[model samples]
Target: MLIDWFTVGAQALNFLILVWLMKRFLYKPILHAIDEREKRIVAELANADAKKAEAQKESNEFQHKNEEFDQQRAALLSKATDEAKAERQRLLDEARKAAVALSFKRQETLRNDAHNLNQAIRRKTQQEVFAIARKALMDLAATSLEERMSEVFTRRLREMDDTIKEGLADALKTASDPVLVRSAFDLPAEQRTAIQNAINETFSAEIHVRFETAPDLISGIELTTNGQKVAWSIADYLTSMEKGVDEILKEKDKPIAKDEPKPEEPKPETKS
Candidate 1:
């Protein structure tokens, strides 16, 4: 090919212009868009990392608060348990003390009642015994000897003053119809004669005397005027003494009623 300097220069200039236009309009704009996109992605990644750190800090704080609450609850429960146990023990102790006091009071009351009862029984028994003895003595004295006793009775009557002698005379005069005297036992002949003399002397009248024997007098003399009679007996005297003694004992035992009680005995005291 023949060499052409002007034409070649013109073509090379045209190619250089085309390359400059393409770089400014198409390639240059595309490279600028890519650089902008890369810058936005870096900013978004940094924002996400900051949000994650804040969330981790909040979680740690919540866990710490929960642990503190648990510890407080545990302390409160322990205190309540201790208080409950103490209260229960106190109630039990008070109840036991009250029960013991009640028991002691009941025992004292029972003892007092028993003592009073025993005293009542003893007093009643003593009164019964005295009454029985008095009745027996009075009955025995009512129906006994009278005959032989009249002579001695009239003799004693005559020994009294004239007034007493007159009284005896009147009493004997009324019975003079019955020459015989009734007695619990027989008298000796001498005793009979002596009694006859006394009766005649006291009455100022010649009075006949006779003797009758009876065994119911119980060691005492009985005198009968006709059907009327006067008598004295050992048993009657003993009975009076026994009654007096019983009254005295009852009074003495009154003081013992305030004393400590006694247990059951062998038997009651013997009375005459």
Candidate 2:
């Protein structure tokens, strides 16, 4: 502890100078190098993170594109399916219409053929009916049938409706000419006298009478005055028979109806 002031001061000054040199030359350079290395590491980390973010963005874009493509594909498939179904339905409808038209045409042809055959049959039947009737009537004595017809005419005149009787009575009263009696055969005096008596009795009045023979009036007798007439004919009776025959033939020839086809169901499409 003996005080040596100069030596102590010199040692203290040298120590301070050595410290300054070490700090300036060694510590400052080391600190600067470490800071630069840290800055470079931080920049590299930031760049890596930016690259990773970009890759993630690219992945997202790819995924979005895939999703869009899938949606478009689905839409296209749906559209195609709808179009195919429409086309198929259209074709089926056309085919069905064609079949219906063909069937209708065939039915029409059959109807035409049936109508022609019916016409021919009807004509032949009418001729046969008339021929048979004429022969049978001819087989009966003409004078006998004509006498019966005259009797029927007198009965019909008596049984006439009130209006027709009144009309005929008025005509007889006003007519300038005598009431005319026509027959298919010449009436005998006795038959003419009977007709004249029957008419006068029916009207409760006396009237002039004339007799005529008409060859065209077959199995018929007619009485006329001032356009009023009363007559009966066998030909009218045969027409009803012809109509009934026509009805029977038409009923038997009607065509049978065919059943329509059912629509087809569409099958489900399988996934690819």
User: Which candidate should be chosen as best, given lDDT against the real structure?
Assistant: 2
Alpha-carbon RMSD of each model:
20.1, 16.1
What is the model-wide C-alpha lDDT for candidate 1? 0.66
Candidate 1 versus the native: TM-score?
0.34
Question: lDDT at 179 for candidate 1?
Answer: 55
* Candidate number of the best TM-score: 2
Model 1 stretches with alpha carbons more than 4 Å out: 1-155, 161-164, 226-232, 252-272
TM-score of each: 0.34, 0.40
State the lDDT of candidate 1 residue by residue for 1-272, as single tens digits.
68698888988998898899989998989989988888878877887788788778888888898898899989998998999899889888888888888888886886676556545544454445445544654476552233323443654555667774555556677764655555555766766777778766766788776677766664455556655454555446556655665577668767877687779788988999
Q: After superposition, how far is residue 226 of candidate 2 from its true place, in Å?
A: 1.1
Per-residue lDDT of candidate 2, residues 49-80 (tens digit): 99999999999999999999999999999999
